[model samples]
Target: MTETLVRIDGVTKRFLENGTPAVEALTAQIKSGQVTGLVGPDGAGKTTLLRLIAGLLLIDDGTLRVCGFDPKTHAAPLHRVVAYMPQRFGLYEDMSVIENLELYADLRSVIGTERDEAFARLLSFTGLESFTGRLAGALSGGMKQKLGLACALIKRPRLLLLDEPSVGVDPLSRRELWRLVYELVDQDIGVVWSTAYLDEAERCASVLLLSEGKALYQGPPQALTRSLEGRTFQVRNISGERRAVLARALERPAVIDGVIQGRSVRLVVGKGGVAPAPGDIGAGPEAVIAAVPPRFEDAFMDLLGGGPRGRSPFADAYASREHPIDSVVEAQDLTRRFGTFTAADGIHFRVKRGEIFGLIGPNGAGKSTIFKMLCGLLRPTSGTARVVGLDLAKAPSEARARLGYMAQKFSLYGDLSVRQNLEFFAGVYGLGGRRRRDALKRMVETFALGPHLDVDASTLPLGFKQRLALACAVMHDPDVLFLDEPTSGVDPRTRREFWSHINAMVANGVTVMVTTHFLDEAEYCDRTALVYRGRIIATGAPDDLKERARGAGRSDPTLEDAFIALVEADDRESLA
Candidate 1:
């Protein structure tokens, strides 16, 4: 028999957290030629596990053998054959896409004979053919993600560890990503993919469910799902947004798992949460309801127990005060182009105070092009974009000064403390002395960083780092906020909390312009514009768009269905 690709014999990894354990002792194994997924919510010890396998973290106990090499002691030798891509894989923003690929190839020490061929193959697989000349900063969320993957693939490692590889990608790009992974597995590479999306995990050969530094379940996704067959029921609530009531019902101990589906929640029966008898749960079982097949989501909810049904802390704590947004932002036939390609075609929109505006689209739909243009990072090819009545093209500095922009993957100096990072940005915003110190203190405290203020940014967890980024972005008290997929890869609870902060900022009359991939997130925006092929094809409130989606021939659609339908329609229209 072929040798096992990875063997972890009771490996335990832990970090000192106020003298408490962060991750407990855990044991797991991954076989060869199979894609094993690490599935969990935020802070579930997914990243920590990957780091441990990559030899980046010391194992407090037990042993790990990757192809017979001990990652802890043989780091240099193991590094020669395995590839680990962290959540924020470094991609040089100022360099062209091709340049970045070549750089990675050189770093891996690929021979000249196969270097060109390797680069071409990686770029082609990533769908970055025509984007070779585009600066890394100019690529969309999906494109940048693909670029990161391509660079990792350039090394042709036998073992691949990818962290949340498809979080912000669109459906088309997601399919392509899967294709690439399949090809890698076909090449006999063992892949360990970490993700929050359980549906994605179903595609893997086996799954290891992690919870708070422990393995909750490990087996074939199919078998684990079959073990709980006939336990789940598709349920719906009569009233919309009254979902709070439905969620409460599903939370009983008897309900093994429940997931939100458009207007209703699919529930799996468990110990304490008994299925509400006929008429007991709105329309009881056998009330002409669909008995849906169990999905990875059902299995996930079963494993973790039903999670919180509301927004994250950032969303819940929104302090809405009346700050009339005076001339928030205006765009008139704003245009951006790349050679013969028009990235933004005659775009026009006005954002007002207390408004939560969103840009929704497919992977290469040019949403990022417009976002960059709005932030003054990329000049418009034609027309004008105004911020607080200041024209970005003519008065770039004046326009940029009125707004705060957070990139999709926000960065911080790894060596700096949370307070230091806050102080640096505060200074950039021109506040200093007593005000800077006070603001720094307030930001550090508000984001719950007071305890970790002295900890280096590099030592912080993903959620903490995200909060630090938010603190830095708004420390200057800007009038408008532009966030590009700010919640991607974040925990569902944290995502909810992040939205609360956004809502709070809007309540204070701060204009919010955001982009996101979580369909449920679309519901939070006051208004969303569906962008496709460089144009706004549909614009309205979430409910309004749902109605339009039904009119477009999809019945009883969720925000995801509405999104795909609108994006498809936009594509067809553009083709026509």
Candidate 2:
């Protein structure tokens, strides 16, 4: 029989006097030897619920018990049996990996032989045995996450709480993280994983879906996904541009959600809403409409009132400007070296006018290095990068003036209000007077950010932060836009909203070069380049790469399958 690790009844927590509760009347049970996913959108109280379980926060009302102890009255004992890893794990960057592990062991009082055994086991399990001497500051994004997990497990607690552990991790690393957590579950450790990725939630033993601090559903992910069956479909053989078709489909009252998948548009029709025909969605006479398997994302969007609809106001406001050159972004033998290490080795790619080119790879695979060199943030070691026919090395400022960049992390001033950040970026991009005011007004209206104009950028939710970042990035309306993981930790609906604007911009002849870990998002790109260990291993359309990985037992493969297969094959060749 499985042990019930946590029990909650009518729990409520609020941070403000009159504001909505962060968590309201939540009731659930978490069992040992199982993974319970706390899934929700930004500010959905997922984090608050996790914190309550770990005894980090007190519930205002309701009965709560963890490991048979009242958290509010017995937090100390609860802490001994529980381990909480926050979104930002407190790893000391200046310390070596081994030193950091030892520090955590000391904090947990696991000294001598026990500490030594735990360190050895963790290092081996996380694949960090070879890099134990490296500094934490120099570790890759995925490696840092593993190290944090190792530290969290130093005490070997019975319950584990993870807050978005795989936020910016690559697919391969994310799979490994899941493996590590399940290994602990096999030992009767209860795990609660909070995440924005619906696919991940689908793998959990059970999921607690939250919205506006209230529980919308609590059960197996399949239960929710099953409800969306017969309503999900694939619209194929599009006569017009796929993006245009998707935009048109989203406008229909019957369509709850729609997105570009390969060459077709995947849609979810509202319950009791009429199913759309090919002609209804602007498809050609020969276009085919087929009912497809429902996914967890479809159900999530359905419960959340669907994603943003209608054409992007930002795209509508963008006036098309012609560039004399055909290729807007060109990188020829781009190379960048740091001391004894080469970060980018002879990389070459080109983005034609009005194209969306994607650069994707594992963590620390030099995608960001190539992006920085092209954007003039870093100088190339031996080759040339140009934007709008201007050499970045010789005419960096001139080249940059025609570019818009959004970093992997939010780069706006946290202390500044939403309005202030917009004003600052506008000035930096040379907008003034009526033009600046008009741009701000348009951005506020486009992203629906009018309500939070005076709020600090740092205080905004994850989705709003992403919107603000994008609004500032495109306020200048540059000819070329560079986005580095623009939708890294946002929810599916937020991603749809972001891509809607991006697709609109591309249709209007604006060129875009983006790097992302979300392979699904790569489907929107005209072409993609796969970088690995400072080199381009493959470059082609998403379907092309998927075809390359298809063989033997697998006739059809997902983008993630192709990514893993390609990387594994390369690893084997390197070993040989």
Candidate 3:
């Protein structure tokens, strides 16, 4: 029999927000040498539940135990036997890797050979050995996450709790992080991993699906995916008109959910008791309909309101028309360097009006550098960038006025209420009187911010924060929108809503330049530019990029597969 590492029964936690329970009567167990995933959307209480078990928050009711210690009263002792890594790992940017590790070891009271041994093992497992002298802040997003994991593992605790470690990491880095987790599990460490990615949840031995402070279901991930096996089907658009056909299919009441796949639409049917049929969406004679296996995401969404509406509610408002527009963003031999480190070199790309252009690369590949240069936040060392036909370098203020930029991190005033943040951005964009008032009201209504108007921006859920950020970025209705990792750490439902608005805006002739680690999202882009080591390595449509990956040895590659294949090939060539 396996030992139970952490146990919770009838646990309840309430927040100060009008006595709302963040976690309600949750019951679960973590077993030694096993990976248990806490899976849910933002604001679903995954974070609250993890905090309860970590003893960061007091449980309002019921029993909770960590490594045989009562977390409520014996949190200090529990801390010694358990390690917890929050969403943002507390690593100092100025501190070197070894310095951060040593600080954590000293806090844990590790000394002498034990400290040295711990550092050796951790650095080897996390692949940070060569970067020991590098500053933690200087590491790539993925490397920083690895360093964070190493610091948490210094004590070699019996139980480990991680909250969204791969939130903004590239797919390859995400896979590497999981590999480290599996290695630790092999040594009998009980792991409780919380994530918004459904694909990651499928890797766990068991899963607890939480929503609205409640445990909706608990079981193996396969059980969830297997439940929807026969109900899922693929609608192939033989003419390759994926987006148009998808938009049409979503209008049918029978389609519960659908996403654009390569040359096809994957649909989950029978929402209103009507079976999905080709005729329902008016499929042409060339269309092919076939049953396909459902993924964990399909079943997960079913539990969340029978999946998202097949169509975006914001689509009609922002994307109802077709318009001819000129190039909104142009880059010519753009390059940037800091000291001896070249961040971006001779990068070139052009985004036409009403097009969604995805800029994808591994962490540290200089995507952000290019974005900053194009947005006029950073001047390029050489070459030129233009936004809305205005030179970003010489006429930055003019260019900026016509564009909206959302950074990777939530950059709103956390101390202010939701309304305050909106009004602040409105004022910053130079709106006055009725325009300001009307814009604020329109955003509140469009993004469904009615219930959160009075809430502090910092206290809102991750999903709401994302919405608020986008609302503030586009408060001025700029002609060009720059979103940098906008959907990072957000759940699928929230991401769908985000892109719906994006699609709508593009439909209305708003050009968008986006940087995202979620390679799957590349499918939504009309074109994608692959960046690596500060250079534009490949540029083409999503399908063209996938073909490139297939040529490089991937069999029927997904967007991520294509990206990994390309990056790995480049790495091999550099090594040679």
Candidate 4:
């Protein structure tokens, strides 16, 4: 049986962004008892749609309905049955996790027996019992989102609306959050989830694909993907190999889109278009462009790249370095503690120069703790860390100066313009004259920031900001680069391009130590350390780690499979 929970009839919203249409009139429908993914780019009016449904934004035209009530006309009554968690969930930072939940329950009119029952169940379900006394500000990104969802669950609303609940969250936490969402729906609750990832969209029952605030399609994510499913040519190439020629061949007007996967290329050729024959793609190179099935990512690229959407670009310089990491960073018995909590317990790892090392873990696996200590942002509770062959604790400043860091949020000065931000960082890092000018010019050209050079960094899109942060990190040519979840919230195409830059740096002999919540990225790392409960639980090549994943209860596991199995095993052990 098909269920329809929320419906939008000719829903339209428009706003003047510097005197332009921020959104166009759009119509969408969300089914009840099913997860509906609202997928699109950064400013494709994702947030606006959520606002219209939440009654926070009044549509310029058309009608919107939720649970049979008009959102604009009967917001109070409609809100009673709906829960909306906006992009940045506002919580009292000073309040304890339990205190925050109690407040939300009171505000939502959840009281006494029902509230207490929900609280207890939520604590156990989310495994948050230990942090009830911890401040909201102290909770990790995943914990905070879980708390946010718990607060929303206080009212037991029939409809749930989430805007990128898993955004910026670690992969394990993301999977857990989705599990909780499924649990809610099993209880007959309706969920309307919005995200930019096609992978996440695969889990949805239906999807409302929006572009420039207009609905392009509305149906099951799978069906929508299957609609245009047809011939795709899979071309294989080495990661750092000369795959650009194959891409260039498909770049003609006849081709729709081309993508890189591990060591293969998925090229979509337009029907009746002028494209190189599969056999004639490259005369000498062993590139095979064989027909294959259409992936969700392929479908997404088709919709996105089929039109005249703006492109994001950045430089991927492959300049070689004279010196290698004769041991870029080495740690022995690294430990970190927060009060009585052990974040990283006796962790040990080594980062070599020119190596692309990926650090991954479950949400509470203590990856961040190790990253902070390695970057010298936090002091270790015990043991030592040697960065660039020097002790981190003894000469922190010099060690820091030798490393470039792109924080989780990119943390570039928001108010400053692209050029201004670049110049500021360059000056701070003691860059001067021709060198600074050349670097700035190259970055502007590479990231396609030429037009928006004067625009505030905050005004840029998520993907652009990701590129800018990376550019800034590489501006001074630091010997070591530390990126903490640098690709979070970025689209898939942009993520690929960003990896291109990282690969260039590795080739240039600048050691890269990265921590990412993305499991697929684990494939790019020469070696990976799976940190869990403040210890190195697994360390090896991605394939080897995948084998360990099978030991954790996953057969024929991918990186994501390994990640989830490891975390779930740890959790079960904890409960036992």
Candidate 3 matches the true fold with a TM-score of 0.94
Cα deviation in Å at residue 446, candidate 1?
A: 4.7
lDDT of 2 by residue, 1-576 (tens): 589999999999999878889999989999999999998888899989999999989999999999999997898899889998888758999999999999989888898899889988999989999998999989988899999999999988889999999988998999999999989989999999999888899989999999989999999999999999899999887777888888888889999899887777899999898668888777889789899999998999999998887788856788877889898999999999999999999998888998999998999999999999999999999999999999999998889999999999989999999999999999899999899889899899999999999999999998999999999999888899999999987888889989999998998889999999888888898899999999999999888889989995668787888888899999999999
* Model 4 pairs whose backbones collide: 5-32, 235-265, 237-263, 313-447, 314-446, 325-353, 344-534, 345-534
lDDT, candidate 1, 400-426, per-residue tens: 877888887657788998778887888
Pick the winner on TM-score between candidates 1 and 3: 3
Clashing residue pairs in candidate 2 (N, C-alpha, C atoms within 3 angstroms): none
Give candidate 4's total backbone clashes.
8
Q: Which ten residues in a row have the lowest lDDT in candidate 3?
A: 316-325
Model 4 lDDT tens row, 1-576: 446667777766767634434457666677667788887876788888888788788877677778888876798998888888877757888999999989998888888898889899989888899999999988888999999888877777888989888877877778889999999888878888888667898898777777777777777777756754554666654334333433454446666766444345556766565445544545235555566666666677677765222222322444667554477888889998889999889888787777777889866678767878888999999989888887889999888888889987659999999989999989988889998888788777766778888889887878889889988887788888989988887766677667766665666677888888877666677788888777887788676777777753555577888776776777798899
Poorest stretch of ten by lDDT in candidate 4 = 307-316
lDDT of 2 at 15: 90
**lDDT by residue for model 3 (228-281), tens:** 867788877546345656667667776677776655678887543444566556
Q: Tell me each candidate's RMSD, in Å, in order.
A: 5.8, 1.2, 2.4, 3.8
TM-score of each: 0.74, 0.98, 0.94, 0.87
Off by over 4 Å in 3: 238-241, 271-285, 310-325, 551-554
Q: So what's the TM-score on candidate 1?
A: 0.74
> Between prediction 1 and prediction 2, which has the larger lDDT?
2
Winner by lDDT? 2
Residue 34 displacement (Å), model 4? 1.1
